[model samples]
Target chain A: MNITDLDTPTLAADLDVLERNIDGMAQHCQQLGIPLRVHTKTHKVPEIAKLQIDAGSQGITCQKLGEAEVMVDADVDDILIPYNIVGKPKLKRLTALVQRARITVALDSEETAIGISQQAIADGCVVPVIVELDTGSGRCGVQSPQAAQRLAQQIMKMQGIDFQGIMTYPSNVRAKPFIEETLNLLSSDGIPVNIISGGGTGSEAASKEIGCTETRSGSYVYEGMTRVGNSEMLTPERCVLRVIVTVVSTPTPERIIIDGGMKTFTSYPPTPYGHIIEHPDAKIYGMSVEHGHVDVSECSHRFKVGEQLSVIPLHQGMTSNLHDKLVGIRGDQVETTWQIAGRGKVF
Target chain B: MNITDLDTPTLAADLDVLERNIDGMAQHCQQLGIPLRVHTKTHKVPEIAKLQIDAGSQGITCQKLGEAEVMVDADVDDILIPYNIVGKPKLKRLTALVQRARITVALDSEETAIGISQQAIADGCVVPVIVELDTGSGRCGVQSPQAAQRLAQQIMKMQGIDFQGIMTYPSNVRAKPFIEETLNLLSSDGIPVNIISGGGTGSEAASKEIGCTETRSGSYVYEGMTRVGNSEMLTPERCVLRVIVTVVSTPTPERIIIDGGMKTFTSYPPTPYGHIIEHPDAKIYGMSVEHGHVDVSECSHRFKVGEQLSVIPLHQGMTSNLHDKLVGIRGDQVETTWQIAGRGKVF
Candidate 1:
């Protein structure tokens, strides 16, 4: 099927570009001697996860049990959830996930581990636990290396828990001291760290430099390199996904309203919400609830009603969370339509 | 059936608040002697549209054919798609929609009208068309009152098209001149204007004052009055829906990470993404891709891991678009769970 035949305000993934992105990330991680564990949060498609694994990724990482459940159903093995599995409901799902596949979780607090440990004991499964360090990210994880050491020690004593290693987001220089201190502390206690997993799209080498055994990169699978503050490696064409939208109304000589809006593309990374592939000069200055207001005043290109624009959204992860399907297209011809299976799997 | 039993980071709509909001909007429009055409884009639930209709809404407004189709399937009789139904795919769906329900559309250009008229002719149906006026929105609409008159005249001459009236968003005092001038221009040509549709959540009085025969409101059904900059009519408890999230990690004394993040809520209306209800003094300072980073230093209440929080998202519509289900609850008991059938229906 042709992409033009599909409905407007749809997601179109350039298959060739997608393949390149997946291969490039895998190769980059491999060259660094760190196995690539692709983060499936960006695309959330089971097929794409399999594609990353096929491209030589060691495993896949999911933030939610619901996402992991979808990946497991599709036979995409070796899933790790880098999140504190808190509450009884998530613990129940986490324990169930351990029975199906090799499920590992990341946590900062002993309360989170205890909840999982109890649920794992009841479900009769050993869930691998990773101590998440703050590393100056200040989002989630223990504030200090001593706190990380304490959580790891507690997890080791728990019956249905296996202490994996340490994990932090966007593995950077700030994480160096904490990770090294935690390693020394754990080694002195005779505890082996199997995985010092660090995450980032353009920071895989940094993760390796910081003594990471494996690196988890998500955005790299779909032109996420630029988003991670590394512009030299990323080109516009490398952006695998483009939101296909049509000019629904050329209201004025200066303004053109597209079929897509905040519902289609997210509002983050602020305005110039999307990069219009057809008209490079057009600026998406504002957005209504359901209409993308494009300022075409500066552009020499003439926009007309019914004309289509392939827009590469500023923030792909936020955009991916809004859509249900991702179309794999080679030029105008569509090869496959995959449901964003992990969409709305926030729970 | 208790909300505490339900999974964290899920949408919870207070049934009592939702019903009150429904009744409140219906009463406000009725007191002003203008019919209410509720916009279902905020909730995207068939049942809520039905509830609005039951509470004296004349019809419902959908932004897309997909949303209109969902409402039509749920037996929502009158649906006004306040968008230019451009291209073949949408026009085909639009024509099919006219057969199932009383469908009306708003457009600012002849090209958009021609496409709809052609499809309507082939389908042997009369599709209602409303000439959208700019009225200073600078989004999608004809530039001036004169452009609106031209489009109305063109619609009157088109085959299988019914010229409904003029339409503008966020109806205010500024729309008065454009609406009145357009009404006079159309009257001079002996063309009767039936429905002068104005839209906004808090401006029903303004809509009526601007010669609007009817008004369309979407956000009011979900505590959207405050979002429209009218805080007098809205209360904190009146916010019908709240995103239920759990504190996954209280990483520091100041920072706590909630299970829900951008995927669960939205990034718009800027900082303090969500109004933390449980701890009023607490603030949602930042967000990771999948975790809400909250600053709780100012709060007297001490947060713990596994603690639940009911957060009122700043912009309800953006948050509503990302979810698949809208779980209705009365106090703590689960009342109903409705699929956001019109979600991802931007096409």
Candidate 2:
């Protein structure tokens, strides 16, 4: 299929750019002597995961059990789920995952660990469990190292569970100090930390400076306008997701409406709807399900109704999940289409 | 499949409540003696559209050509596109749609009218075009009466198009005044107005006061959090769409993590990630792609890992597009499951 033949308001991945992004990030980690565990939550396609693995990634990291299921289905041997897995259905799934490959999950509470242990015992498999420490996102994970040690101690006492290491996704600029404090507290109690994992696309450099065994970054593989707005290293072409929006209504001298809105392009960090690829002066002011409000008041040429514009989303990770398939384009030419195999893998 | 058996995270609708909502809206419009043109953009399912049509909606309104295609595929007869259609490919699709049903499209520009005229001429069909007048959403449509008259004049002169009537969405308190002014302007030019369309769920009472011939509202069939938040009459059970999320992690004494994120619920209008159904005290602090941040600090009971929470999203229209299927529930019983056939129909 040609690029133009793709369904309007769809996600298009530049395979060549995606490969460069994967190889570049993997090479950076290799040069730094740190392992790279790329997160699969961004592009849930199995083919993309294969490319990342081929680029020398130590393994793939999944934030959810469903994502891990996809990575495992893709035949990626090593999988690390940096999320606390709970619920009988998910635990049963996780324990079953252990039979096929190396399976490790994050634990932030004793209650969570007990459930994992029971599921592991029932499945007749011992699973490695890591402790998720809340460095700064302040959203999840255990708060203090004391809490970590307490949780880890509880997990160590479990029969079918192995306490592996400590993990934390530190908030921006606090990686070094937070890691040091947590390390001192855990090691002081004589608890060994084997797989200290932390970091994302934004904090990758700071994460490496903290001396963690591995770093996890997802969006770096498909840099977006939001990431590029913050980081200077990302190139626009490296962005794997693009929304092809058609101009629906040009109401005034200043505004043009596009068919792609919040449904097609997700509004995260609440940034402008999207970055207009061809028109630099056009800015997305607001959006609804089927209409995008573009303020092109400053642009010289007017975008007539029915015109299609490719937009790089402010956030790429969540946008791809909005669709079912991704058209893999290699420089204005579509190579093939990949089903977002694990789309809506929120569980 | 039973709604409970669907294995989804948040299934909140009571079948009884949904029926009441649908009936209530239809009855309200029936009592007022105004033709109801329910917008199908919210519930893109053809079954719901059929129900609305069966219950006495004058016709159905679609926001995108893709959605109209789905509705036409389901054999829906009368369809109104409440958006400006432009471009050759889109115009061709609109022209092709003429063979299936009676298609009435909104027009706001002479350029677009000319384009559609050419396509309709080539297709050997006379297209019914409604001039969309900007009442106040400030989003689309012609602002002044003069601009609407000029566009209507062009439509009358076009080879394969007929200026049927005028349309406007209620964005301000003066919608009636704007519609009246546009009608007066067109009549001054000796143009006949047949279908004067306006109104939504929010502006139904106001719409009747404005006295348009038809009113289009989609959210009334399936109430959402946004409508519930603003409406004095609706309840959570009346809401037809919800994101079923599982507690992935309980990070702190205060916060509980759920597996539904922006992908499951669109964060338009920037409300807290989601509203907990039974737990009103819980505020969704933040969200990642597949995880939700629930602030449970004020709650007495700790949310055990793996527990399911039903989160009511702010916008129901966009949330309906996030999933492929919807299961209608009556208490704990699954009544029916409908495919969101219009999911991602953003072309």
lDDT of 1 by residue, A1-347 (tens): 88888888999899999998888888887788888899999999999999999989888999898999999999977998998888888888888878888888888898988898888889898898898888887788888888888888888999988998999888997789989999999999999999999988888988988999889899877774337444333345778878999999998788999988888888775567777877778888888778999999999989999998898887787788888899999988999999999998999
lDDT of 1: 0.86
The DockQ-derived docking category for candidate 1 is high
Considering only chain B, report the TM-score of each candidate against the true chain B. 0.95, 0.92
Q: State model 2's lDDT.
A: 0.78
Give model 2's docking category. medium
Task: At residue A30, give the lDDT of candidate 1.
Answer: 79
TM-score, candidate number 2? 0.90
Provide the clash count, candidate 1.
0
Give the number of the best model, judged by TM-score.
Answer: 1
RMSD of each candidate?
1.9, 3.3
Best by lDDT: 1
**lDDT of each prediction vs. the true structure?**
0.86, 0.78
True contacts kept of each: 0.88, 0.68
Per-residue CA lDDT of model 2 for B58-103, tens digit only, reads: 8899988888999999999899998777766788899999778999
Error of 1 at B210 (Å): 2.0
